[model samples]
Target: MNSYIRVSLAVLLVALAPVHSLFHPGVNTITPDAPKLRSLGAQQGILRSVAGSQNLKSQDSLRLKGGVTSILKSLKDALFPVETWEMPKFFSMSAMMFMIIYIYTTVRDTKDTLVVSTCGAESITFLKVYGVLPAATMFMLYYSRISNIFSKKALFYVTALPFMAFYAVFAYFIYPNREILHPPIPQDLDERWKYAVSLLSNWSYSLFYVVSELWGSVGVSVLFWQLANDIIPVWQANRFYPLFGQLANIAPICAGQTVAYFAHLSDKGDDAFGVALQQTTVLILAAGACFMLLYHYICVLGERD
Candidate 1:
């Protein structure tokens, strides 16, 4: 009986392999050559970048495009004269690698791990359904009434758009500014008090990262799900949910390919323009999503039987 159960489990695992791979961070389609392009561009003092490369009008210049090789190659060029971009790219890659490994290990250990994954899901749904969304809706509605705010739909777009625009701008600007914020802590702490102070400081930074990640994940997840329910019919939820979720996965796949394609393109002098193009594309997507959601809600309200 135990052997039969093991065989059945093994078959189930095989059946689910493709679905599991879809979400696996390590299973990226982006090639390893992308970093090489960034490094080369760095060596040439050409400001190596997928975005930069994509901007070049010259047909000879490398164009960052969708592929594994293109991404690493682009990064290789981006490294430039002083080899400065390498460290940041390394750190980013390391974090990604660690996340992939950690998630893989956790999934494997789920059989013996006492983690209440379902309980956490329930807690999230409970909070969003009962507490968070309700509070947010009330707050927004109240503010809307007092301010005679434009349609809730307009407010949603207004809130979402500025945040997105800010994020893109911040990524380009404030992201680099982080290096300035991270000063080296004094290691000359011979005293216990100094050590305690250093420990507290480190803890504070760690706490900030944890809070940021948690808030970002929760906010996006809640917004997407709420948007889904608003747009998708209750009867079609099961069918459309899977489809939409798969569509969302397209971002990572596309990012990977873009990273590759842009690597070569950037080498040919197209990075800046490519970056602008991508940013414009994202903005358009956000606008379309917001419009659909608003339209759906309007339809729901108008259909009074």
Candidate 2:
């Protein structure tokens, strides 16, 4: 089995290398800005005029608040709704959930994944897929008192509730119009069931449906990766991050495949179901972040026990 796997990988790499090379010939062969090429004919002249017109549109801007005092006032007003009202409610709910079960699950799941799959033969073993740097660090650090400081239950409830309430108030008022939450649908139901069984499911519309559904998930995933760089630690991350991150990158692909299958079963167009699936994931992540903050507090408090 091992020999066959190695042979297969070798063949796959050989097949892809030439294809990659042929498609991306070097930049040196490319011509510079084509000044002469711009005046091909009347059509080219019109194209250039339109391009110049569009370029002018790019220069427009708002020159509001010429000084620091006005800027400061603007900032305060922008933040006021969240700071005054929404932050409090969010934190209140967060704290309640934290007192119930936030950090416990995180720690438990981490331990389970680590202990169960350490250095296994599985194609995507937890350690190999996730890397050893962080996992090893987490195991080592887990025994340290400093790392455990935030692991207590009592400390969690004390620290979690107040900050969460505060953050929640701000979060709520910050974007009062934003509706981020969406509940999940039944797991067994497929989206395609609607089209498979219904006469009104237009084939041409399916193309638009699929494209719109994918654009959001993909576009947002790209945005989140940009967001992650600002907050994710460079070092000691392997030691700190949970085991599930090993499969995190592949998750979207797996999810797309799974949901596509479900859509086929449901008779709903694949695109429609894909959109719903991605929206459902976004809702879960938002809720999970709130819950995780509370859990952190509980873990700190539990250490006292």
TM-score for all models, in order of appearance: 0.33, 0.19
RMSD of candidates 1 onward, in order: 37.1, 36.9
lDDT of 1 by residue, 1-305 (tens): 99999999999988877777678845534446757776786877665565566666443443433454777767765532113533332222223222222222222222111112212222333334444455556545654574465664554455445434543444355434434644555767665444334433333232222222332343344334444455446654544444443344444444444444544455555344335334433543454455445444444543531
lDDT of 2 by residue, 1-305 (tens): 99999999988977776666577644222334444454466678899999998776654422232456678877875544234433443343334333223222322232233233321223123322333344335433543433357533343343334333432332243223222321222335455442232211221122222222222332223222222333334552332233224323344454445444544565565444334333433433454465555444433443432
Once fitted onto the true fold, the runs of candidate 1 whose alpha carbons sit more than 4 angstroms away are: 1-155, 176-181, 189-220, 260-305
After superposing candidate 2 on the true structure, give the runs of residues whose Cα lies further than 4 Å from its correct spot: 1-122, 126-277, 286-305
